[model samples]
Every structure is written in C-alpha cells, then in structure tokens.
Target chain A: MDRYAPPGAGSAAGAERPQAEVRVPEIPGLPAGIPDGGDAPARHEGGEGDAAAPEAELTPPSAGDRPAQGKSPFQALTVIGQIEGHVSLPSQNKTTRYEHVLPQLIAIEQDPEVQGLIVLLNTVGGDVEAGLAIAEMIRSMSKPTVSVVLGGGHSIGVPIAVAVDRSFIVSTATMTIHPIRLSGMVIGIPQTYEYLDKMQDRVVHFVVANSRISQERYRELMFRTGELARDVGTILVGRDAVREGLIHEVGGMAQALASLRAMVRQGGRHQR
Target chain B: MLYSIIPPEVVLRPADGPAAVLWEEVEASGARRLILRRDADGRVVIERIISTEPRDYLDPALQPGQPYHPGRRE
Candidate 1:
C-alpha cells in the first residue's frame, strides 16, 4: 500500500498510476455521489442500511459527534508545511508538493460526486509561482470553496487563504504579509530590481482582487517597516485578519462548516 | 479527527509522558497512545480517549447545551 493511502487520507494517487483514478474515501457525513470509498456500499436489505440512509437523507453530512464513516457533504483538503514547487525540498522537510496538489485539484474539479470543498491551511509558504498557481485553480473552480487558516498562513500562503469562495481564520491564527524576497545570489542591478518589483506586483494584485483589502492598504502592510526584527511586514492575528478584510470571518471549523452548509442549502451548491 | 473514547471513570494519567495536545489525532491507522494498568487479580485496565479535552479540535463550534456525542439518529 502507498504510504499516503492510509484510510481517511482523502483522494490520493494509487500506487498503480501517478494520477490515475482518484478515489476519495467515504467521509461518512458527506453527501452521496461523492467519491465512493473503493468498497461497494454494503447492501443491507430492509433494515439497518435503509434506516441509516433515510435518517441521513434529511440532514446534511456533518461530524455530528458520530463515529467517523459518518456521511459528509464535502471533501476536506489540507495544505500544511512548505509548498514545494518544481524543485523538490529536502526529504526531511514536511512539504506539500504542487505537482501532487495540482493533479488532485484537477480531479476534484472534474469529479461531480464531490460537492463543495473545505480547504484547511497552515503553511510557512514556499515557491510563489506554484502557490499562486494552486490558488488560481481553486478560485476558478465551479464548486463552492471555503478556506480556514488553522495556524499561520504566512508568505505566499496569504494569497491562497483569500483565493477561495469564502474564508475563515480562527481566533489564534496569524497571517504575515511581506514583500516578496528572492533567494540565492542575485545580480542586484536596476533590471533585477525591476524584475522583482514586477513579480511582487503580481502577488499584490492577486491578493487585492480576491480579498476585501485594497491595493493601498495591502501594499502598506507588505512594505511596513520596524515590525519584524529582521524582516519587513505586518502580522495580522485572527480578528485582525478579518477586520483588515483579508478573511471573511473570524471563526474556527464550526463557523466555517456552518457557512458552507448554508451555501449548499441555498442551492448554490446542489446536494444529492 | 479520530477519537479513542475513554470514560471519565477510568483512571488514565497521561501515560508515557505529557503530550502537547495540538493537532495530534489518534488516527484509525495506528497513530495512537495507550493507557494500561494491572489490577491485583492480574487484570489489565485500558483507558482510551473517548473524548478529548480542548474538544475545539473536533469542532470549533461545538458549544453550549449539546452533549459531546450526537443523539442516536436511529
């Protein structure tokens, strides 16, 4: 079995194919038609299965304090550790590869069984291009998407937190906004500075467009001085992020799920 | 989000050592901890985490008037 194929790991590429048929495990509370859990549904003729299906029919799939394998209405996608792009990071480092995530996002967008999505993010961030690319794919998805910044969504992670349809930040979560900095030896010429400025503009524009914050305020935060002892930027914690308009609400998993359920119930996201 | 239910009556005192109770979920796939005790009759007692403290990890919104476990839907 693939190391990543542990039960409830969510849809992962099978050991057979790199990105072959993406099979999502049955997160009990999710709606039907959602990716089947590889195993065929148990056919209980006229008793337990029938009773279970009907009871779940009236209500949306939620943890509901039920033992897992509870039906769920959406898939949970987590983005933890550094976002590893084209160049692989060291083996010891905890990384979320864009190559892996890119394929998964495509599969999720294509799968009709999967309804809405809840993206959980906790990253120190990495490659700007790869992170932005994933953010764009999520933003362009047809299904509703909600993001919750569980820990610190810093660096390139800022754009991702705002890329979804709706956003949430827990009371303890923090986000850092700073000017993009390139690593490795640089030419340090006028042209090099110009190139860097252009790239930073791309991130600035994306952040402003997707979130409630304006270009002026965002830039102010990005270039703010005297905040970090070694770096320049502003750190917005929890409600601060919401007040700044970067996140839609100051909430944890409960509020985020409640909002998503309302969106699904409103028919914007058709549930089976 | 896997929880090993240990009843309150069971005397379990953080076996092995103190663990930082953050982001650590006892996955069904064997990421877990066990609490065990040998009784006078040589019977071993096991206490599992039926519910976790700072239950915020389970559902950030699970609050007020609701029991930790769901009502029997059946």
Candidate 2:
C-alpha cells in the first residue's frame, strides 16, 4: 500500500493544486485556471487562486474532468479563432481565405470585462476585403487595441497594423506594401481603371488615416518597383516601416504592451 | 501594478502553468520574448511582463479523472 502511494504524494506537490483551488478571491469574474467550486481550497489570497478559478469552472462539459487539461478561459480574451481565418461569413459556404477575425473581435468589443484587444499577425495576406474588414473592426473598437506583427503582416495587413491604437513589428517581421489585387475578371475598359482607382483609394485612405504616415509616403511605398513581382508591392523591414511612419515603433511585445497599457489607462481616464 | 512595456519572450504557455495570464513566444526586438498575456480586462495582452518564471502549469496532459493539476500552487 505504501508503494502504491504516488511518489509526489504528501509533499509540497500535494499541497500545490488544492491550495490554488481553494483560493478564489471575491473578484466579479472568475480567474483563468481555478476550478468551479466556491468552497475548494481558497488557500492563497490573491495568488493563483484568483487566476485559476475560471478555467476550472468554465471548461465545457465535453472537455471532461482532467482539470489540468482545460483550455485557459479567455480570462483575457485568449485567441479564440484563427487570425485571418474563417468563421462562416453569411454569404460564403467556404471559409474566407484571409483573416476574418470578426466573431472574436465582436466578442471582445462587446465584453466590458475585455478592456483592450491585441491582434497578433503573421499572415501572408489573403482575401483583401476580408482582411480590410477585420482591420476596420479593430480600428473602430471602443477599447484600446494593439497589433504585433510576428512573421509577416503583408498585403491587407498594412491596414491592420495601422488600425490598432498602436502597432509593433519585430525586427524580423516583414510588411509588404502593394497595390490592390484582383482575381480573374472580364472588365477591360476604362471602368476597370475606375474600379482599380477606387480600391486603391480605399486601401491608401484607410492606411493613412489609421497610421501616422501621410498618403504621399504610403503611395511611394506602394508604387515602388523592383521590390516585388511584376505588379506586387514593396516590402518594409521593421525599422524601415517605422521610419516611414507606417508603424509606430520598431519593437516587439514590450512595446506592444506599453502601447496597450497606455491606451487602457487613457480609456480608463475617459470613463472616469 | 501595470507595466509600460513587456518583452515578447515572457509568454507563459499553458504547459508552463498559469499566472495572472497565459502567454506565448513571439518575434520582436531581436529577443525571444512573450507575445501575449491575459490582462485584467480578459483580453489577450500582447505586452511583456517583468518576470519569466514558470509560475503555474496549465498542463493539458493531466489524468482525465483529475479535476486539477497535481499540487498546482499559484
């Protein structure tokens, strides 16, 4: 019987998890990892008890009882859907090719508990309209917003980075600036040019309005040649993008957080 | 306390356990840092944190019948 006892039993290892479970402080919303029972351990004060409660409680029934195995509750809006992925657009049976972050974005915006949003991007730039739509939603968010470019934030992502209250691009992250593209089409007249012009104007205007850069510089980057394919766009490195004012800073997580915190602080002040 | 900035490498994975939030590694400023954290607002905070310690474990591979991690100390 003694050999059957777990090696870690009866030690600090035994004391750890129960301690967290018992320690749910009186916060309005439950913490991320703690279990559901109000009368668990509540051992620690404001420690992990507060953070762990929600994850333990909110986990779906289908998830089963491996308390240690639940997905962290979006205690803070954890990424629910894939960025630039799909979520059943009303019109299309197929998922949108680009990042259609609307569902989660809407949830975050509607969530009063969600005081801010952070968008992480590493897209190769798919479906322009879809990307732009996501960007617009992020732009209009009442809560503070920040975007961090991971591997890439190309094509439609140009608008996304600027849409946030602030944006960050890691030194290795690459951002491509290109003109609006189209799929197979039939129009070959002056009307085609008009369509292109309007589309181009939309991208330019959105990027310019959201970012600190002027339209002229944005155009220069977009129209620059020898950077992309026969009709693609220019690619900017982290520092170059910042120098061009398309991005606010040539930073990573720290800068992104600082920006978010500032925005949250600012937003808090306004509410008060 | 709030941080003005957090590096992208300080991200804590679910496997590493939970803290005030969960985090993941991201590229930026030429260092391996955290790219995300759950903030007080219930949002995935992309800011950096001051500590890189493995605070809590959100291990997904724990026993099914178990309702909690073995001795999960906050």
| Local accuracy of candidate 2 as per-residue lDDT tens digits, A227-250 | 866554578988888888888788
Alpha-carbon lDDT, every model: 0.55, 0.49
lDDT of 1 by residue, A1-272 (tens): 00112112221111222232132222232223222222232210101111111122213334454444332357666777667665433222345556546655665666666567788888877667888888898888887888999878887788889988889999899998887665334666889788778878888898899988999999998889998766778899999999999999988888877877888778574221
For candidate 1, give the lDDT of residue A143. 79
Q: Residue B65 of candidate 1: its Cα lDDT?
A: 21
**TM-score of each candidate's B chain against the true B chain:** 0.24, 0.27
> By lDDT, who's the top model here?
1
lDDT of 1 by residue, B1-74 (tens): 00001111121111222111101111111111112222223222222221112222253323322221212221
Which regions of candidate 2 fall more than 4 Å away from where they truly are?
Answer: A1-100, A183-187, A268-272, B1-74
